[model samples]
Target: MENMPMPKTRKPNAQWDANATKIFNEICVEQVLANNKPQGCLNNKGYANLISQFNERTGRNYTRVQMKNRWDALKADFTTWKTLLLSASGLGIDPKTGTIAASDDWWEEKINVMPLCKKFRFAPLDNDEDVEIMFSGASYTNTNAVAPGAREGSAGNGNGNGNGNCNDKDNGSDDVQEVYPSPAEKQPVKRGAAYKSPKKGKKNFRDM
Candidate 1:
């Protein structure tokens, strides 16, 4: 019930922790597998289930508005990540690490062009699989596997609105699938360009 927004507050200064976020994304992915998405969104029932599961797993009492806010925040960051994937140049995906690898100069230039992408310089999104499950759309446009009617520099930006496809019913279930490598697995490499010896960590879950 994104449009229904209620409960404008949370436990005073309460925030999500790493494990909680992991559990939350896991639930979202489960919901997607269950086909609970309608109109490219998890319907009221799906969100309700999410709330229940998230609270149960994390022991936090985040309300609808809080959950919705987090959902929106994650979507926005994913959109930005996709945007960088499509718009950046002189960057390569590290096969071993699954992170976008580039040099200091490349990172500098890219960050200057899109500061929102700065975080990606170090790590990748933690639950990108779950993110796509909930918000896959034209906003996820990419070069090799582009979405319909989407082209380069078209991954949800000011020039266009990235609307999701409407399909299936509301609510869903989950597993923990990290699309990109976690920081723990990363081994620092010499800061030279090319996909050689790339940094494995995200612009990791810290920014997610």
Candidate 2:
């Protein structure tokens, strides 16, 4: 009988590559946002920056163009994630068959894997108008919480979307609802209403 060749051992899969890439993409996007770094709208330079950071930390080599390509891939992955979330929200997320179905456990798993954190945090359940209604003054809760949609005007006045304002405006000018009530005593009164009853005013109308 011919001698049989020994089977070669396969190299173990590299888990770090996937995890490192995910971390790299997330940090780059966050850093760009935090520093208010400008890379032009629709620019993927942020993705390159992330790869650079990752290489520096891990001592791995990656070309800029390659990083850009990876970034593009990441963007595509993000779109998939968005779709999955949408589908999961509508149909429940089923982990067993990898199908969306109704179950908190599956849904939570899907949410936890989201690269950008919970979508709810970035996009509230309510509309802009609803946010305004929830975060409005007097009814606002967490007095310590930053006001929504309150921005410091060019003149340094807390005109729109400033910290003092109850309306918590996001960095991108999107408004987030407050959903809390102020102290009952400080609540505003209706227009043309008097502190006391109009009993005394009744006599004034008759005299007129």
TM per model? 0.58, 0.34
- Residue-pair clash count for candidate 1: 13
Candidate 2, 1-208: lDDT as tens digits = 9999999874322233545655554555453333212221112333345556777876766544444444334443344443454544335322232233334455466567763323332222222222222212212122323334332121222212222221221222111222232344222221221122113321110100
Residue 86 lDDT in candidate 2: 50
User: How many Å off is the CA of 170 in candidate 1?
Assistant: 23
Number of clashing pairs per prediction, in order? 13, 23
Q: Highest TM-score: which candidate?
A: 1
> Stretches of candidate 1 above 4 Å error?
1-10, 94-98, 138-208
The TM-score that candidate 2 achieves is 0.34
Best candidate, lDDT-wise? 1
lDDT per model vs. reference = 0.56, 0.35
Q: After superposition, how far is residue 131 of candidate 2 from its true place, in Å?
A: 24
Question: Would you give me the overall lDDT of model 1?
Answer: 0.56
